[model samples]
Structure formats: structure tokens, C-alpha cells
Target: MKITVMTADEQFITLDVDPEESVENVKALLEVETRVSLQQQQLLFNGKEMRNAERLSSVGVRDNDLVMMVLHTSAPSSRAPTNDLSFHPDGSAINPGAFQQHVRRDSDMMAQLLQRDPALAQAILGSDLNGLQNLLRERHQQRLELRRQQEEEMALMYADPFDVESQKKIEAAIRQKGIDENWAAALEYNPEAFARVIMLYVDMEVNGVPLKAFVDSGAQSTIISKSCAERCGLLRLLDQRYKGIAHGVGQTEILGRIHVAPIKIGNIFYPCSFMVLDAPNMEFLFGLDMLRKHQCIIDLKENVLRVGGGEVSVPFLQEKDIPTHFLDESRYSKQGSLGPGSLPESSGAKEKNDNMPTGSRSSGTTLSDPTRGPEFEAKIAKLVDLGFGREAVIQALSLFNGNEEQAAGFLFGG
Candidate 1:
């Protein structure tokens, strides 16, 4: 019977074979024709895989049927027979143990035997035992060389005081490694230690109540603790069905989201949305989505979170007013000029102070102030004319402290 065989690379070949022949016979012929070993040939018929022991007629294979063949390069196992051991070089019966010992001790005899049969040489080279030993030795040498180079480079990076960029790179790498190791160790030993470490927390207001929120750039969606949401009356704003599941470190929970929840950071307000989850003893988490939308910048080294970087200096809460709640007491002691008590409450509340001069207070009046209704409306209209959503423009205006220039900066920052 004649059949057509198609290869994975879209090559085709026509072959004539007996209908009663086993699939192994077809594989042997394919190996001779295509140089693909019988063990590496994967045959498929009618979209189903074919086994070597299966007979062509038993599998419903008919004349002119099409079969697909895929070739792989996996080495044969060590225990697999590579060559016939029935005859010796002197045409005598070969003993397996004596042959192995002779091949091990007599390199000249091994070479002469391999030279006589090229197939045996090819089989030995393609065996897993030879390949695995070479691969393992190469990997070990590469790793040792890599480790030595890293040690030398690190020594130079630390010894050379003038190489600032290298020093910075090394320090950043070490810091990231330390953070990963410490976080893993903490999770293993004291899972609750995460709550006490508040290096990324920022003071903000939900609705009108003061609250602390964590800035998590890695998170895809902003999250509000259920307790915090309840306290701020944000639970009442939940309009969407709580069908989504949130995955965390060691837990997964159903989450409810509140759209357009008013959040105030410093003196600016942002109409942000948050997924509400039942996180105990933890504050709100502002994710990358909200941070990117607001063009927020977190500068840990300077210890200041700045928004709207250019000419129009937006209203910002003094660093002193922001609290440091890190578990590491050393950070508390290292708090330089930006301590909580450094700025007077009156100075920090300059825009809201009732005792300020009339001219000064009028100049500081923002869109958030109820007295600037007409001006706020005009600013919103102008921003909407610039192709921004009314709600988004209003939020941006509040986030920029009512400064039209700063609001425009925020919108176009991306």
C-alpha cells in the first residue's frame, strides 16, 4: 500500500509499504530516509498520535492515508542497545563483560572497533550518558568562571571610590536582594511584620477623614481596606457586583469596588476608584493605575512625594505633617529636617487659615473652595474644551490645587 507522510516543516514524501506492517517498520524506514532516529520520530494519523507497536491496519490506516511526522533531537538512554554484540573482531562469540572491560582499558581497540562501524560511533555520540557528562562539566566550569568574575568586579566596585555609577548599581542590586530576602524571612518567621513596616505610607484623606495609605507601584489596581472604606462611608458608593477575586501573598478573597471615591492627598482631591478587600489592620493601598493617572512621584531618598513638578508649584502637605511609621526605629532617628513638628500647623494650613490676610487668602483660594464657584466652573470648562472628561478635569483641577496651569501639566504629563 502507498501512503503520504507530511513533516512538521511542511515537507512531504510518498512511501510504499505493506498494510499489515507495524508502525515501527514505517519509523525505521523514515529514520533511514530522513536521518531522524526511530526513537525521535513522533507519528500522527488523523490528528491522533500513533504508537510504534501499533499495526498500520489496526489503526484504520488505509492506502493513500496521510500521516504527520515530527522529529526531536533527544539523546538515547544509556541502557539502550547501541550496536549488535553477537560477533567479535575475530568472528568469535563476544562476552558483554569482557567487551566492556576491553573498551575501557584499550583505547586503540575501541578506536579500531568504532572506525570499522560508523553507525556505532554515531550511536555512542548521540547517547545520553556522553551528552549529559559533557553538559554537566561545561555548566560547572561556566558557573565557576561567572562567580570569579562577579567577585572581582564587586571588589573593584567597592575599592574604587570615584566610580559613582558602579557603586550606585551595586548598592541598588544589594538593596533589592536584601529587600527580597528580608521579606521572605519575615513572611516565614513573622507574617505580621509587614504591617509594622510602613516605609511607603502617605497621609491622605478619604471623604473628609484623615487616613494613611500605602503607595504600591507593583499593584495593578488600587485597594481600600474594608474597615477604612466603612469608616469613610465609601461602602455606600459600591455600585458594581463583587465578583472579582483578588490574589495576595497567601490568601485570595472576593473584592468589591467603589467608583469615583473622593480621595484627598495633601490639599488636592482625586476622584479615584478602589477595590475594597477585607484587609485587617492595614491601611488603603494606592496602586500604579492611580499613581500613573495623577503623575505622582515618590522620592524615597529625598523623603518627599512631589506631584506636578514644573512652574506651578501645587499645594503640598509639608513633609513635617506626614508621619513616619516604619518599624525600623533607626529611620525614625535618622529623620533629618523633615520631622513632624518642624512645620507649624498654621503654616501647613495656609490656604484654610481663617486668620490670614484677605488678599493673601484670596490669592490662595483653590477650585476646592466653595467661594470660587464661578472661577472653578470656568476652569472646568476650559479643561473640558481641551478634550478632557468633565469628571477627570474636575479631579485634576483639585489635584493641582485649582491652578489651571498645574492641572494642564498633570493631564498632559504622559
Candidate 2:
């Protein structure tokens, strides 16, 4: 992207930038030129928070695009940088343009590096921002760029373009998906892929106890279940405002103690990250942290999520077939992660009470009877083979309203 950086004083510094550079990077550039602390800057990319990890090209920033940067004060000194652009600590001049250009070159070179080493660039570029700024100031521009590029490219042989062409491919696919044109057009379209399944790893060590969990992609965030948090002594993180929690379908409850982890998924992880909400009743909802890096191929029928140019599969979804008899239509209508407004049909979901009779003794704990048929049995066999503990499969199937075909497609890839 070619961005014209109008400093707080209105001095414009136009520079061509890598489309994949983040808005945070743009802010860094402004800080460099304006001698403004990052905390003192307000950036609006279309009047919203300048997107992080959202590539400039995807956001419609062209070679001569003008970006606005303002300096904000009144924030505590702890927040704002010390009125300085020189991060060298030893006092040095930062060439923002050269620094950024070098970063762009490194990203370009990363395309050619070894596949197993892709995270290398992100580690260096995203981490130690202050250190990198110092290095850029001290080193010869060309030498720095040359060394990193060689280091990056020597590791690989191909790079994917993150540009309009890529987005056109997305738009074309949306058009072909048979979606309503108006709805599709109405979406200003998130730059790059907007929807994401988060990828994260847990890091918790308190009282000599290390409790870890891999961030589930389908899960919204790093969930420290209320039960788990209490037992683990991590409850201090949540201030008991009791804002409530959201779970699969629309179920909500006042809960506490959960944190989010920044992770890499699809392809890359982000920087200066945040934590996920802590809620006792909710199962968790993964957000942008996981989704941003991936170009996903969601095969509803196949129940597969393909990421990053289809080089590999994350995990296959276990499908369950729903049966017709016990299928309650309303159960499947539930949506969200909060409240009974849409709790998924699970945990022995009860059917319409009135349907049973004036006085009936319920058999209890039954979602469906197994005598339905061999075809149904076969679907159950598939789910069983998929390893959805029989109990879970039964619950998910009941919720899917006995659409065994849909459930199987949903739980286990067709």
C-alpha cells in the first residue's frame, strides 16, 4: 500500500508499503515521523479501529492513499511512550520508511523460505518491536534489508499474493455459492477473511501447577471453565461484575475466570494480543485471533475445514445423523453462545411437555430409541466410529432434529 502519513502536525510522508503490513505498523510509522508515542495516537481506518493483521491491500489502501493519524494526550504516563521516537535507549534516529521497507522485503522473502520455518519471520517482525526499531536506526539500510531477505528467501521458493486478485477470488466464490445478491453486496466485505476459527495454546502456571490446554478451533476462546478455574486457583483474573457468559446456541449465565490466548491458525499469529472472555456456563467462542491467518474452505457436506492453500487438513469433523421421530424442530433453531434464547439441544433436552399426556411417567434420560432401523443404525455406526462418545453423538443428533444426514454431515464429515 502507498500510504501518505499526515503526522499530527499535518506533515505528509508518503511511502509505498507492503499490503500485508498491519495497521499497527502504520501507527508505528506515524510514531516514528511524529515523535509520538503509540499510546498517544488515534488511528481510524474508515472511522473504525485500524485493523490489526488486516493487510493494507485488502483494505483498499492504494499507493497514494492518505491515512489519518492523531495524537491523544491525557492518558496516564504509564501508557504513553516517553515523548520519543528513538527506541535505541542509547539515542538514535529511526528511519521509519527504511525500517518498513526492510520489513516488507523480509515478508516478501519469507515466501521462498522453507515451509517448516514460516513462523521465523513473524517471530522477528512481530516480536521485540522496540529492538527492531533500534536495529533499523543503527544498521545500514541496504545491508539490513539484504541480510534479512537472503535469510528469508533462502528458506523457501514461493509466495502467495495478498491483494485484490485474492479478494476477487473470494467474491467470485460468494457469487457462485448461490447466496442472495443483495445480502452479498450489502456486506462491505471484510478485508481478507473476516470469519475465523481461533487457534491457541494455554500457558498457566500458578502455585507450582501448570494446567495447559490446546485452544480448540471451533471453540470461541480459551475457556477456563468455571469449575476448572476454581480448582486451578486462577479465579483472580475475573472481576466479579458478573457480566454473564455465552455458550453454544443462546445460553447465558453469570460466570467468571477465563482468558484468551493469541495463536497462529490457518497460517500466522498476531501480536500485542488479548484474552478471551471468562464465563462459567459458556463452552467458549473462538474469534479473529484464529481466523485471520486462514483462507478457509468449509465443506458443509464433507464436514471439512481446509486452511492455507489446501496443503493440509486441521481435523475432520465427526458427523452424526439425526433421526426423524424424536426430532423437535424448535431445538435446532437455537443460536449463539449465551442464554436459553438458543441453548443447543443437549444434556438430555426435554421435548414439549404437553405432547406426552395429562399424566405420564417419563422414561428419563432418553433422546431416542435405538429400534429405528438399520439405516439409522448405520449412521450411528459412522458417528460411533468417528468417536463422538455415544452420549455426545446422541445429544447432538437430537438437537439437529434427527436430520441424520445433516447431523452426520455436521458431526462427522459426510
Candidate 3:
């Protein structure tokens, strides 16, 4: 018989199972299919919780029946309020029906109260109204004290900027911090600074297998997830003594380097080296090392990744077309830029340059030009908001000599 399983995220999967199979056995099958552990799965059938020892037939499960599975970090609480009550504080008998109705009216509040006081959970289930009332009062008092302490801490942190002692303490704390402190400070003071650039991704092939790759200019070296390498059968054990560490925002990890790894994008095939990291969340990253070597240009305006100076360009997959697992939706926007500088201007810019005398333009071009100043940052941010990565947008603008229309065209493949 086939059973349809639905997850909390609304993902559905169909499984064939024996009539005598237990709920735990079904969970084992789900673990293999979904990569979710059995312990985290809470299976429900017909609005009733399914026990590990319960048989499918015993639970009256039919073919193609839908079973709901909720994933949680911990087991769900089984406590529930009953239609019974205890004596009140004044030695008066509480009305069982009224107390039960109150608990039923705000089930979420009662659940929170039970979570804060596990000892009171049994009292609630057993209808010990007086015990539950006392427990709730104590929990409320604890929350009040916690909130007061948090408020005091916030007040001290935001004390008068002109207060020398407080400012000195703040400076000292910042000085003692690591790289994450700077990121936090930037997030707090200059959110737009980081928001100007967004992550870019493209579809590429590795050993004839389609793979999604993140385009990151800031990464010193190309990196591939160990899982991807292994899945592609490209992972070869390196010398044990050649271990190295890779540092990124807020974290660092040891990596195993692989050389001469071939990656194919469109018609071009490039043999590059990559540092293999155990990055499960991100499978592939095409870093500066590969981009520079290929003279690759990511045209956000054209919506393509050009190789060999536009000799060959592959259009990127639309956000919706890309696999849900491959992209981090939270970090990207859906809006796209259509205005000037949002298209490619390769032809126009080249024509203008050809008309000008050689060496007429300044020889000095700084790496920071595309990303510098409020106007440039604003343009990049706007393009990013339109669903393009900041680096790709900046690169397109630079390629077109800051022509917004050309960059935008380039991104949209216009």
C-alpha cells in the first residue's frame, strides 16, 4: 500500500509500505527519503498522534492515506487541560466547566504556561486549577524580572554618547571583539553597506552533471562542497599533511584542496582548482580565482555570465527555475531593474571608445570605483533589489563604463 506523507513545510512524498509496518518503521523510510532524522519527526494520522509501536492496519490506515509529519528540535508536549477544577485560594470550589472553558478559549496561552512550568503540566491535565493558577503567577513574575533586566542592559548600552566613561567602555569592548563585531557594527550603523551587494548564482556543469554555483568575487579561491565533489565522483583524498584553513564571515573551517578540477559553463571548459569544504548548505562557489583566469564578466543587466570577454555567454536560470534547495531565498529579492545601466552597453561603450583618441581617458582606474560613493552604491542596491547580485551588477556597470542602461541590458541579455 502507498501512503502519502505531508511535512510541515508542505512537501509531499508517497511511500509504499506493508500493512503490518509500525509507525517507527515508516519514519525510518522517511528518514532515508527526506534526510530528516526519525527523532525529529512527529507523525499524525487522522488528527491523532501515531505511536512507534502502532501498526498501520491497527490504526485503520488505508491505501494512499495522507499522514502529517511535523519536524521539531524536541519532542512535543503531551499535556492538555481537562474539564475538571480544584479549590480556589479562598477555599471555594472552582467551577470545573468554567475553568475548562477558559483554558479552551486561549489554548496557546495555556501551552506557553505549561512550557514555562513543566511540573504544572500534569496539574493542568489533571484539572488542578489552584496549582495551575499559582504556577502561572510565578511564571509571569519571572518573565517580568527578565524583561526588566534586559531593559536595564539596553539602557546602559545606549547611554549618552558624550559620557566619556561609557564611551571608553564601549570602545574597549569593540577593541576586544573579533571580525564578527565589525560585521555587527556595520549591520547596525550601515545596513545599506552590506545590502548593496547580494549573492549571485549560476547553473554550470561539472563532469557533465548540472550543478549550481555561487559567484563570489571576494572569495580568494574557488570552493566546492565536499558533498558535491563526492556526488560528482570528483573527490580524491589529498595528502593528510596538506590541510589548510579557510576563513569567512564569523567562522573558519579546515579545507582539502583539489587541483585541476574541470568545470564547464556553456561552451567553455575551464580546469581550475578548488578548496573542498564541508558546506552542505552551499554546494559550489565560483570565486575570483576562476573569474580572473577566464576573464569572465557577470552582466547583471544582461542576465548572463560572459566568458572570454563576451565571446561566449550563458544566460542564468530564473530564480523560480532554480532548485529550491540550491538558492537561499532570504538573501535575494525578486524585483529586477529595467532602467538605464540595467542593460548591456558593450557595443555602445566600444563604439564611443573607438571614436576617442588613444590614451584620452585617464590611465588610473581603481578597484573601488564601481563600488564607491553613494550614487554607485545606490545603483548597485537597486539592481540587487531587482534580484541581481551586487558583484554582478557592479561588474556590469564597470564593463559598460558605468552605463546603467547597458549594464541593465547586459543583465537581461538584451
Candidate 4:
């Protein structure tokens, strides 16, 4: 059989060998071909780590499979076999237990990094961080830009209160898609910005108590730290032991039980899966498998993850609505003066006011008002409630095409 190996350095090594070769033979061949020590490197097929003990059966090794080699550069691995350690027995002979101890130490470190950040570990195991970091950073930037585009798309998706005819035009456009007003509205987020993306946040629960997580989509798998698992009251149910080594990190033992909680994001709820990692640096990580189901809109260019069924507008600073110069002085200081930083008191006062707690802000508004039900008597009450500016309510309802439940999700993503 002919085997091709892809190194982390973007190099490829093709070897003609027997199909019965053990994975250890491939590693040794790779070490000889690439000058990377088998004990100091890990190999992967596709995206998963490949063990040296695996045999290259026809199903396991085939042509065109992406075989990657990751070289170990830093960090002491307790998993890899090393002969650096020795202990003198009472007879002054070298004890092999020292080598065992080294292997044990490396195993522990590899476990830790895997549990803490499997994706990062995957990168390290690939013997490449630069490529992975660049990829993630690019993804993040795209998310930010996506948010900006969403802001620009709001007028196009929703009928503006001030633009009645424009509103009708949008309704007409979506109506042509064979969609009802409600369904259209539910999916009416800016396609260029909020379409075809799934964004999620981590919600950890300890005995059913919710915990907030700032999710990083770049992460590969869920990693819950030991302390967090303890706090969440997770008792160790089993040991998911993995033995491999990554560069510049330690190993870990992942021990925790699965806990489910409602993850609410912009009118979306996901009951999720979690794994406990023993890293002190990590709180929790949400992986990619769960995100593929929902319709997610991520503005990678905007640095914001809009979870589901709503527009997440990324704020940008622009010059607009500046107060006209208050040439009237003592009588009219409210007219505003100076440039971005011309007035010291104005800036300080502005900062002080900004620092104060905001009363409350919801991501959305109610369809009518909560106090008013669907009854005729609630009509007047509804109108009264709409007085908080019925236009806003209309806009929010328009967001859901009138599905108040979803609209509430977008509006009150509290």
C-alpha cells in the first residue's frame, strides 16, 4: 500500500509500504523521513489523533486520506515513553520505574490540555499554532463584519414605522416567497448578515441552576473546568481517558457527568451536552456538533454572535446628531460645543452618566402589551400600552411576522 503523510509544516511524505504495517511503522517511517522523533510527535488521520498501535488495515489507511504529523516541541508529557529518568535500587541498579513515572507525568499533562481545549490541543498536536490562530482570528473578524451588515439590513427586512409604504414593499417581497407574514418575519433577519450561521452561548447548570457562558465558536468540543464542575455539583461518573501529547501544554483527566440546561439566545433555546475538563484556565467550551442544527447568523466581521431568529446589530461610532454649537453660552449650554474632547466637563459628565447603571434595556418589545389579552376589552388597554410607542412594538412584531413567542425571544433575550 502507498501511504501519504501530511506534516504540520505543510509538507507531504508518501511511502510505498505493506498494508499490514502497524501504525508504529508509519510513525517510524515518518520520523526517518521528517527527522521528527516518534516519541516526540503525534499523528492524525483526518482530524482525529492516530495511535501508533493501530494497524494500517485497508479500512484504516487508504489513498488520499489526510495524514498529519504533529511534532512535540515543548512541555513534559507523561504519556509518551521516555528514558530520561532513572532511580537507583538498594543494590545501586537503575530502576525502570523512573521511566514509568515520566510516562505517567506526560499522560497527565496531555489529558489536561485535551479536556481544557481540544481544538487547541488538536492544533498543538498538529505541530502548528500559527495556522490555527490565523484561521480563528479570521473567523472572528468575519463575525464582526457580519454584525455591521445586519445593521444596514434592518430597514430592508422590517417595515419602518416612519416608512409605511416601504414596509408594505418588504411584506410584498417576502409574500412572493410562498411564506406567510409570520414565518417570513421569523426568518426576516438580514440574509447577508444573519443568515446561514449558528451562534451559541454556554449555559452551565449545577443541579439545574443556570450559569452564563461567553461562547467561542472556534472551540472544537465542550470543556468544563474542574472547579466549575464542582460548583455545578457534577460528580465524576466515568473517566474518558485519552493518551496523546500536544506541544507546549500539559495533560489532563476529564471527569464529569452530562448536565442539560436551557440555553437561551435571541429567542432560541438549546438543550446541550457538556464534558468536564480538569483545567483551571477554562470555565466551559461549546463545541461545533450542536450548532449545526439551528439556523445561525454570525457576523464574523462584526465580532458578535447572534444566536437565532433575530438581528444582532454591532454598534459603530459615527458622527451624527451632534448638538449645534451653543453660541448662546450661559442661557443655552445645552446647544453643545467643541470637538470629541473639547469640553472637559462635558466628557467627564458624559462618562459619569455612562458609568451609572442603565435602568433596563430589552433586546425587543412586546407585540401589544402584556397587560392586554386578546379580548375586545383588552383592545383599549392594548392601545394604551402601545403608547410606549406602538411603532417599536410593531417593529418587533414584524420581526416575528406576529409570532409573539419568538418575538419575545428576540426582544427580551434577557
| Angstrom error at residue 410, model 3 | 25
Best by TM-score: 3
The TM-score measured for candidate 3 stands at 0.34
lDDT of 3: 0.60
Write model 2 residue lDDT over 1-414, tens digit each, in one string: 467766677655555567777666666555544456556777655656566467676777777777777767764554323622234433243444443344345443344222323443443446555655555444335434545654444333233445666556555545645554543553356312222222232332322344333333333223344554555455566534333333333334434323433333334442212222333333232333343444545444665455555654444322122122112322333332321112212322222323334464223233332225676566667678756766555544544434454454445431
Model 1 lDDT at residue 226: 74
- Candidate 3 vs 4: which has more lDDT: 3
Q: Which 10-residue span in candidate 1 carries the lowest summed lDDT?
A: 338-347
lDDT of 1 at 369: 34
Candidate 1, residue 350: the lDDT equals 17
Tell me the lDDT of model 2 at 80.
Answer: 25
Q: What is candidate 3's lDDT per residue for 1-414, written digit by digit as tens? A: 889888787766667777887887787556534545566788999999899899999998999899999986775433222213333443222454454454444454355445544565555566676675665456446544655654554666889989998788677556546555875786688655443233467788886778877776655457677788888777774322334333221122434567676788887787877766655556777877788998999898998899878888887777677666554322221222111111112111110122224564213112323334788777778678768887778766654445575566556552
lDDT of candidate 4 at residue 178, scale 0 to 100: 54
The all-Cα superposition gives candidate 3 an RMSD in Å to the true structure of 22.8
Candidate 2 similarity to native, TM-score = 0.22
How close is every model to the real structure, measured as TM-score?
A: 0.30, 0.22, 0.34, 0.23
Model 1 Cα lDDT, one tens digit per residue, 135-211? 43453455446556656555756666678877786777687679779757866896553232233566778889888
Scored by Cα lDDT, where does model 4 land? Answer: 0.44
CA lDDT of every candidate: 0.56, 0.44, 0.60, 0.44
Considering every candidate listed, which one attains the maximal lDDT?
A: 3
Clash number for each model: 0, 38, 32, 35
Error of 1 at 381 (Å): 62
